[model samples]
Target: MADGNGSEKEAVVVSNKQVVIKNYVSGFPKESDMEIITGSIKLKVESGSKAILVKNLYLSCDPYMRLLMRPQGWEEYSLLKSSQGLFKIEHTDVPLSYYTGILGMPGMTAYAGFYEVCSPKKGEYVFVSAASGAVGQLVGQFAKLFGCYVVGSAGSKEKVDLLKNKFGFDEAFNYKEEPDMNEALKRYFPQGIDIYFENVGGKMLDAVILNMRIHGRIAVCGMISQYNLDQPEGVHNLMSIVYKRVRMEGFAVFDYYPQYGKFLDLVLPNIREGKITYVEDIAEGLENGPAALIGLFSGRNVGKQVVVVARD
Candidate 1:
């Protein structure tokens, strides 16, 4: 291609692979529900345009993404408006993938929901559901760092061990083996829980509500258990909240992006000094993105699930 001066113009084009939804999902999502397709794009930004073309090195496979597979919800990344709501990676000392989990949205979620929403106090008894996950793991660690006694719940024994041994939770349990959640909470928090980081809602929420102390705070981060269901499960313990004077609040990480600088100020130092530990389950290629995403629903991934599209 030649420009106005007849000099050769260089335009680099590349194949863009995307994992797109095949159709709206009804129940538990499967790998077949999403398809990876290849398209091409010019690696150049238009003159006087605010758009910036970025190479996505890592992609986060969060549980909330399942909701977007439905017809009403929209996909997150788009070729256009790429610069909007994007944060620049300022720190290079740590692994870049950390931005997808501990240093990114999930990290902000744990920060806002735990410190801001929960109003955590030193020596408080804290309980975290889905504790081995990207956000829950950090929430447990943050609670421990805040001088609170932390207990976390996961689906499998491996994750249960990871919670106590890796993330430094005071105690951890496998929720799958516990037939009665109320009894589980009673056994873990005999004195009653001061703060509850709600992740997997449903019976867990109901159980936590029954075990909350007076003036207890519940930070509702997500309800992964009810995402793919045709009808969401009902929480039968609403009356207990009134009697216990529990303060339950639901929060969105989107509302807290403006505080990203403050979050990095606290987290980056801890990460650099080894005060914080993080684990990631990496899917090596974009083609594996579907499996990585589906793994979140079934507890297949050991830690934060991430897809690495490129290395450089």
Candidate 2:
């Protein structure tokens, strides 16, 4: 084993492979848009930077990763930017790739967005769109732990089943089969939605808006449905935002990272106790990263998508 200085009596040079974004992307990024280059791995950490050097093991494939691959577009400070909350992964069990989904940004996204933004209360009726995805899955579980009646929507029948059986959602439905989102919302939330975790956006948001109880809250995490399209579908029921006196706000997880420790305190115990469950679809090797990423928009991943780069 190396000493604290990260070196032995003799200097050692280790080969390193890094996954680099080919460049900013346009439309859906292809496999060619990313390339893994080899280099030397430094065993030492630099001073004055909170950025820790990680030997990446499990990298996540999230829908928001699309924006980063996009040729610099209009998307704001999300996973897209030159140095935004992009994943230059390095995960392991101790600091594993699974952490990237449950304990990383997605975890924080669920914590801050649910606790701070949604501010859910016991017995509240909470509904989450794309509830089987990374952030949404955690949000639903958190809501359940908060003693709320939680429901979720997913694209496939299997995912819907997973949400209900595995994630402990009170109810779940396949949005693909539901011809009308409003109907699905009503069916699951007859009492009306007190908290709506917006993920898919577009029609789903509109549908949730119509069913939101008075003084309801909405945490807008993303709009995956509109990401690839040149022109996104507009919400015709925006007026409902005013009439319902609903509070709707969008958020990015990075701004809330400072409180990550506190959030983890609240979640880790539950995770260890089996009170909370997280899902991940792991892709091995950098070569599979592209397909894993592209498949996100199509709901090809059952839960959080992770890519493994190297192992210790």
Candidate 3:
């Protein structure tokens, strides 16, 4: 150790590992779509560039990242959609990975899409597809917090358990086990759904439209089911949207960055008080990033998937 601000430091170069897209993909993404490679970077930043170097402790594995892997113009669309409000970790006490999940883009998507877009009220029926996912889990919990009857659909029993037992959802079912989506929605929302936080698309959207109450709101954050499909399925029940006079709106999380401070103030205390809970599926090491990312399309991850690059 040396006196503060006295010693001259030497720069060190290290092997920086990265997971890069091996090639543009056409259909469902596989681990082969990406490959881990190493490059060298200086441990110290340049003297006057005003650039901040992040250690990259956690890399988020979000479903939207998959859209970028697709061939054609989607790569450009992905960049435009995902380029704003990037986070740089500052606090070290809380898990750094939270920035990639509950405190990050997914958190804002759940907050803005539900409260800002859906305009939820007390005792309303709220249904969230892909409920065990990062954004969906948060949306279900927020609906419960807002005094709504909350139900979620997942792909596996474990995810269903997480929705009901951990996230405080009123009910949850495995969508894969339920062949008739309209019946599944009917079973969960006997009174008809007033708010649907739309994550998965395709037949789920069609079913939800038919089951929506008058003036029901749908906040479209993503359409994960369509991201990998060569030909996206058509929602035949869109006519129901007009018939029921429902409000259907699509939103991106980028539009809500100004509310981030307000969101943190509301959520951080709930987390500390155990009123809110979050789950993450962390894949240790950067090399596992490909598998962790590919897992999203196949429903192999139970919660928010994150890849740990470095530990401090």
Candidate 4:
């Protein structure tokens, strides 16, 4: 326990194993790009600093984490930003790892992107790409809760089934099997998409453009498909946005952190009563972090991927 002076009765040090990016990645990240190195840190908060010392129990494995691994301006800020959202682990029935998924950043993202950006209405046709992912799964669920007809697209048949059965999506299809995305969207949403939760971008965005209704809203959350590409694929459909008066907006979860308290109020009860559910692919130990993160690009993870650093 910390005292008034921000010091523990006795100093304690522990070996801290970290998975760090060795260099800026050129294309798709490999397990070799990150190395697990052992270091040591004092388990005490600094006397004057505002920093809170936390025993990191779980780390989130998100597709956006790839952006931080690349050559970016001030990578430490990305790390610190996530640290800012940490929740203390006390007595709880839920898994501690839930903080890294549905109950935390990803949940906030889905909430903000759908409600704030897309402004969905009841009976609206909502389509979520990569719908089995951390954010997308929640987005599809939120749309259902809001009384919208929701369809999800996933890579594998198993994931599509999870989206339909577990997450309660109105319709779900394996995107890998659907070579023509436009035809697939037409099959699922014959009336045309009112709100398109864009995740897997690229050619999907182009196909979605042709299927969007007049005055449609597109919440650009992520583009996992183009993240590893040397040159991102171009979407030749800007004319549709003008012709249909479509509104497309990109957003970051950090901007909506202030509404977290309200978000919890709305979601917690649903989660507790079994009205909402989430999926996670947890990898044990810090040493496995590299592999867990690298697996995301290959669609190896079924849902939200998490890496456990310590059980307690």
Candidate 5:
């Protein structure tokens, strides 16, 4: 640890760039609400400390992050107290960015929500909202692989096409073009949906509830439509759950992290054998983080939105 002069070398310092909130957000978020600043930090973690310092390669932009922009929400940085909650990347043959989408939290959310929460049966009629997104796309693919008739609803014609053509959903529709969601559901699923992967809530949930078959299962994964609103729109068909004997349940991915290994075992093989496919919208550099993160609420980015800070 000494130079030619026998003096100890100083710890290497680097300029660390970060995206920080300029102020707590209200309503829809904008790029101006966040600021990118550079700060210096030593490369080494302190001795006797349990902290781990990591260089971020990819950062995920998800719908849930909109809530973290509020004053009461929680946020975490690259430095960690320990590796307790971290999952090491075991398979690197696939794109490392997969860790941000298909091999990461979104993948887990789709797996746990569909297989565990929905308890799907083969040949069942399944529907997914926000169908082309990170989680919804996987849910659709999983249903197809499991012998279910999967239908997905996306916001745009392009996304709807991606859902049907790229991801192999049985059917996909642009929800924006559908005037009556109830009728739309009836068209895609004449027999009524046996399983619904609830991503877009409010009106869509109301329609899905009305169209659900007896003893249907609804896995409430997320409600992207309600995130930016001051007052979330209410679903009027709560009583339908009673009459139809539907099992409606909400889940968080954090609760299923314990089964991460099990999830990888199931998905990795499918990924390798071409039984599954994934899509991502990648925004490069830390400077563009704000815009990339803000893009989620507006459905501006297709597929899984990822921010690449560095490659190495």
Candidate 6:
């Protein structure tokens, strides 16, 4: 390490271009749809405004950002409609990347989507999709910590290995090579699923639906495998939800922003003491950002897909 001369760098805020969604996407967003065009940024925060001016050191590449790609979201809710200040920045002691995973949208999603939505009980049976990915990995670990029997499904064998060995998941399998998804799910979730953390929708969801236990709960975090498709796949096991008395729900992390502090308070200590661990698949430079963002659909990213913008 080298010592500095104790000089502060001048803040500049002439123009900033961000990756913004051009329009509502039907399915599978292309790189061309998002462009880095010129936008304004204030160098200093205004007084009386709790807003913060962040340099965006690192950006999280999350699946839900795809939903935000659509113009109409919770930000446009009739009762919650906002004419101004939709996207704002704030400061935190943790790395900016945390906002993408742990402290960010995905973390809160895993927290609220699991505990609040799934309403997991101790030692219950749990299954997660995209288990080694950002949200699934954390969800599996969370289930284990809650004394639940957890199994996860990933797209690759390496991710499966990491889920079972590295993340301490009870069991994990690669969905890609699995001949029959339903049979695979039945083999792993032999006792039926008490809680299903839905990640990749379509056929995988159909299988989980067929194997759900009575009074099961399903938390719809995302459908990565279905994001890129022009037409979303329909689940054939819809009757199971009614027969099994399953409760399925969809949620967004933005609605739970108020609970973020409460969330960090719960997860931070675990992180510091090594009780919880997070994995990231970081891509350097902004040029490769497009590919990294698209990789989520393909299940190419081993963990959380993060893009490094700048480091200060």
Candidates in order, TM-scores: namely: 0.94, 0.83, 0.90, 0.91, 0.94, 0.82
Counting only residues 3 or more apart in sequence or on different chains, how many pairs clash (N, Cα, C under 3 Å) in candidate 6? 1
For all candidates in order, the CA lDDT equals: 0.89, 0.80, 0.84, 0.86, 0.88, 0.79
Which residue runs of candidate 6 sit more than 4 Å off their true CA positions?
A: 1-27, 35-53, 70-94
Backbone clash pairs for candidate 2 read: 25-70, 25-71, 26-71, 56-90, 57-91, 92-95, 92-96, 93-96
Decide which is better by lDDT, 3 or 4: 4
| 188-228 per-residue lDDT for model 4 (tens digits) | 99999999999988999999999999999999999999999
Candidate 1 per-residue C-alpha lDDT over 1-312 given as tens digits, one digit per residue, 9 for 90 to 100: 123222214666667777888888889999998887776666666666788777778889999998778532112223566567776787988999999999999999999999999999999999999999999999999999999999999999999999989999999999999999999999999999999999999989999999999999999999999998899999999999999999999999989988989999999999988999998999998889889999999989988999998877
Whole-model alpha-carbon lDDT for candidate 5: 0.88
Per-residue lDDT of candidate 2, residues 1-312 (tens digit) = 234353334444466665567677666566677766665644544344344444555667888877777342111011211334445433223346657788888999989899999988999999999899999999999998889999998999899999999999999988889998888788888889999999988888988999999999999999999888778889999898788899999999988988976887787778778898888888878668777887898889989988877655
Any residue pairs clashing in model 6, and if so which?
A: 99-104
Candidate 5 deviant stretches above 4 angstroms: 1-9, 70-77
TM-score of 4: 0.91
Cα lDDT tens digits for candidate 6, 1-312: 122223413434445545655676667677776655555544644445555555556777888667667642211001222225344435455566766787677888899988889999998999999899889889998999999999998988899999998889999988888989889988998889999999889998999999999999999988877777778888788999999999999987778878877887889888877888889999875656767887877778988888887764
Model 3 residue runs over 4 Å out of place are 1-9, 70-93
2 or 4: which has the higher TM-score? 4
Superposed Cα RMSD, model 4 = 4.2
Candidate 6 local Cα displacement, residue 143, angstroms: 0.3
Ranking by lDDT: 1, 5, 4, 3, 2, 6
Sequence-dependent TM-score of model 2: 0.83
Model 1 accuracy (lDDT, Cα): 0.89
